[model samples]
Target: MTVRILVVDDSPFMRKSLQKMLEEAPDLKVVATARDGIDALEKLEEHKPDLVTLDIEMPRMDGLTCLRKIMATHPLPVLMVSSLTQEGAQATLDALSLGALDFIPKESSFATMSIMQIQQDLQEKVRRLAASPRFHPRPPAEPPAVRPARPAVPSVPISAVPIPAGTALPASPTAELLVIGSSTGGPKALQDILPALPADLPVPCLIVQHMPSTFTRPFADRLDGLCQVHVKEAEQGEPLKAGTVYIAPGGIHMLYGARGPKGCVELTPEPVSSLHRPSVDVLFQSVADHYRGQVLATILTGMGADGAKGMEQLKRKGAHTLAESEESCVVYGMPRAAVERGCVDLVAPLPDIAGHLRRHFRL
Candidate 1:
């Protein structure tokens, strides 16, 4: 199916470049180009495109403003085009919160990279998003009351008995660690799930959301602000703590080592063979090695099979696993792959995920 798109950017050169790249794939059709947020709104009405590729920094109305307007009225898939800068990362996250579906990060050295690679990445995102246009759970009309993310909770035991293939334990309420992986549609998916987690959640959660190094800090900060669970980018050698969500830094792998109730962070830059830097497989494998039967792993929306193998490792180690069902996933690749591998114990829709987690850990 051809995914109709409108490219919105203030830069003429970038707009044309993106257009040429997208046209390389027959499935992606650039229906119009908008110079800024104002132009984007006008073109949205005129073209009625299936999706929009929006640039965050634009004159005469920024991408965030345009995104708010679009999500309020038209509510189409909008992918933010962001730069790999601190400021760009923060604004792109703002776009996500305002209901942008996904994002593509641009580097300052974009001219130095191969356009072919960019074309493939861009087209793939467009194809996946247009194919699955279900809306994410929108935030409420009024903000939910802000409870502190970490309230004191009772300690729970960690099970050591291994769970066999095709088997799952009932919700233990004692799961000691929670790890999550996502890519294409993560930010919005997380928005739906994280805010609903109980303030006194007992597990320490680590996340590997496929994003640029520049983006992770701001993304974590944004989630921290909005979520009942405290969120932050993982720091090397920091001990794991309950009720906090640690996002893997963008360019480094977040591996766990010397496991216990108090596990220390282990970051690595080697083994750059994977498609993503803070690889889901790397993190999952590390957790499976140490946490074993005490773990609870979740695979959310993404475009690749990065987490499948590691999820398999976790499953083999008796960890309970959950995969987002296809109906709720924006791009169902990672979770589908894990499901195909027989690694997943439960298949739940996006909105039910928070409840599933709560019931599992009895938080």
Candidate 2:
């Protein structure tokens, strides 16, 4: 089936370039091109394309404003065209929280070293998003009268995990370390689950969310302000500590190493052949080797099979494992792989994951 798309950008060259590149795909077609958000909105009514590729910086109405308006009015899958700079990363994340499906980085040097890679990546994301049956638009948000509010994730209380009277608790909670991996739709999913964790969490949490180097620090800061548990980008040689969430920085692999008696973050550039630099498999395998059965691992919404092998190893070591159910996943690729590999112990919807964690760790 042909997936009709609307390409919105202020640059005439970019619009033409994107249009030409996208139409090269047999199943993809650019139905309309808009100069800016206003033109895009008008085109929306005229063409009603299956998807939209929106530029973040535009005149009259910016991409974020357009996104808010789109969610409020016509709601559909929107992919952001973002720069690879720090500011671009922040806006891309904001777009994701506001309901964009995914993003393709727009670099100034695109025509030089990365054109083919970008084209392939963009086309793939467009196809995957267009084919998803479970895409849900967020509740209508009016264009913010002021700066947008940080997502106010409701914290999960200890009482929320109901234990029936006389029910035997595990002799000991199975995990001492918590590791999570995701991609595609991870930021919003992590926002939902991480904030629910109490400040007194007994285990240190490690996360690998496929992202660029410019984005990881901002993403961690964004989560830090909203979550009770402290969140920060993982640093080289930083000792692991309970009650903190350490996000693996992009562009490098995060592994575990013993610094005297404590486990510390070890950033490396080895395994240069991995599909992703900060690969979920790398981190999960490190944890499986170091902590073994004393780990709680989860694979959330994503678009690849990166975490499956590592999760399988974790399961063999008796680690407790969970996956976000298909109904709650935006892409369901990573978790589905783990489940199919016979690694996942439980599959629950996104909202219930934190509760399950709390119950397992007896938080």
Candidate 3:
């Protein structure tokens, strides 16, 4: 079936460029175009496009407000197109929280960039969103009944302080940097893990969760509110410090870089590498290059094999690599690929991954 899409943006040039890129795909059709969110909503009713390419900064109603309205009413898949700046990053995050499926960063120069690059990304994103299950908002279900508690494991110190109860304590020689990569099901999975980390974790963390712009900041804020550790969207040249986690902003790739003695994080808006912004491969390879033996790389639930080669690189560099066991992943593609490539040193269930980290640090 041909996938129908609505192109929504205030910039006439952007709308034209996007429409042109998307229509080039034989199976994809641009059914309509809207200059702003209000117009898009009206067109949404008339055209009922299967997908929407929305811009964050539009007049007469911003993209995020429209996104919330869509989720609350129409519930169709919406993809945000944003700039690669701090404001754009934050707005993208807000849009995700409002239910945008994904996003793309506006190319700085249509003239300089190759059409192939635009076509490839636009096609992939639309294909993925088209394939995605429709959004269904249901009233919250009651929490599952609590089960009997298991006997607690003995506590250990990862640093100067004793680890908190329920937290996985890394054994001596604990990792100085924890690197994580995830895609589908990542936001929810992160909700599970980040809050469980002790507030006094000894190491800083870097994460690459495949998502579009306007999503990561909200994810970070959600984690920050739930976890004791400070969580923030990564900024270029930001120092990797203990008790904090840096999430790679959507619509860009984040990589580890050197800043004097300590490692730092950098975000790039260069063309998509390995089929994704915040690509797992980009982050993992950089971690392997910079931190090498001291890094603990975890491949979480995601689609595709983006992280497999990077995990291999990490393993060869003597870093400890962990893959989420298939039984626990929302989609087992990434970790499974890593395991098959013989790059993963260990496979652990999601709930037990923290425990594994603790044990690996132990002598």
Candidate 4:
């Protein structure tokens, strides 16, 4: 099926470039382009495109405002295009919370961007969003966003289920550390899970969220304001402390090591060549080596399989692992990959994850 798209950006050049990039995918067709939010809505009603690539900064209504209005009124998958600056990062995170599905950052000049990365990312995201059953179907007048929510993964019952044959469920450890990794739909997913965790959570939590260099700090700020647990972007050589959540800063890999006998975070100097700098695999591998059997790793909703190998390593080392179930995932790629590799001990929905953590940690 042909995937219809709407390009919404204030710049005519950007709109054309984006259109050109997207249309390069044989299955994708950019049906319309808008100069801003108001124009976007007009085109939205006219074209009823399968997906929208929305720019954050625009003339009248901004992307965040438009996102809220769209989610409240139209209810379709909207991916945001944002600058990679500090402000851009915050707005992108805001857009995500307001129901934008995902985002890609544009650097100083949109034209100077590495087209190859943008092209690949654009094609992939458009195709994935289009494949969803929620995209526009035959009935033109029918609403797109009025679909029912998927059932979350059921909570871990009082009496745990038997372990599947080959993998041994680690004897429930008095979990000392919790490591989390997410991307794409991560901000909202993290919001759903993090705030609900008790302020006195027994272990320190480490997170590797895929974001741009300037975005992680603002993201942490937002999470800190909302969550009971103190959330901050992780820093180099900082000692790991309980009851606080450390978000791996963007553009660097976060790993675990020790300062003398005290366990501390190692923020590396240079960015790795991996697709993601704050790679989940880097963090998870560190946990596998340092925490071994004393850790609990949670893989949340994201676009790629980054955390899968890391989760596998954690699982093999007897760490308890959880993957968010598909019904509760905005993008099930990461969790699905972990489950496929037999890394998770349980698969829970977004809502039940916190409770599951409490139960496992005996909170």
Local distance difference test, candidate 4: 0.82
CA-lDDT, candidates in order: 0.85, 0.87, 0.78, 0.82
Candidate 1: TM-score?
Answer: 0.86
Which tens-of-lDDT digit does each residue in 162-248 have in candidate 2? 212222223355677889999988998999999999999987889999999999999999999999999999999999888999999
Indicate the residue-level lDDT of 349 in model 4. 72
What does candidate 4's lDDT look like per residue over 1-363, in tens digits? 898999999988889889999888888999999998999998989999888999998989888788887888788889898898888888888888878888877767667756886789888988776553333333445567767888898778585433234222244666788899998778888988888887998788999988887988999999999988899999888888788999998888999875533378898844457778989998898878876338888899888899999999988887888887777677778988888887688887778887878777666
> Which 10-residue span in candidate 2 carries the lowest summed lDDT?
161-170
- Please name the candidate that would achieve the greatest TM-score relative to the true structure: 2
Candidates 2 and 4 compared: the better one by lDDT is 2
- Distance from true location, Cα of 150 in model 2, Å: 60
Clashes of each: 1, 0, 7, 1
Which candidate, 3 or 4, would have the higher TM-score against the true structure?
A: 4
User: Once superposed on the true structure, which residue ranges of model 1 sit more than 4 Å away at CA?
Assistant: 109-113, 133-169, 259-261
| RMSD of every prediction | 11.3, 11.1, 10.6, 7.9
**Residue-by-residue lDDT tens digits, candidate 3, 166-249:** 333334345778889998656656766777777777788888998656667767877798888899999998888887999999
Candidate 3: where is the Cα deviation over 4 Å? 107-116, 133-177, 183-196, 209-227, 232-242, 246-279, 282-296, 300-304, 313-336, 339-363
RMSD of 2: 11.1
- Candidate 1 lDDT over 1-363, as tens digits, reads 788999999989889889999998887889999999999999999999999999988899999999999988899888889998899888887787777778887777776787786778888888888766365443447967999789789999885522223323357645788999999889889988998997798878999999888888888888898888899999988888889999999998999877545697888996788779899999999888776448888999999899999999988888888888877888888988898887788888898888888878776
Segments of candidate 4 deviating more than 4 angstroms = 132-171, 260-262, 269-271
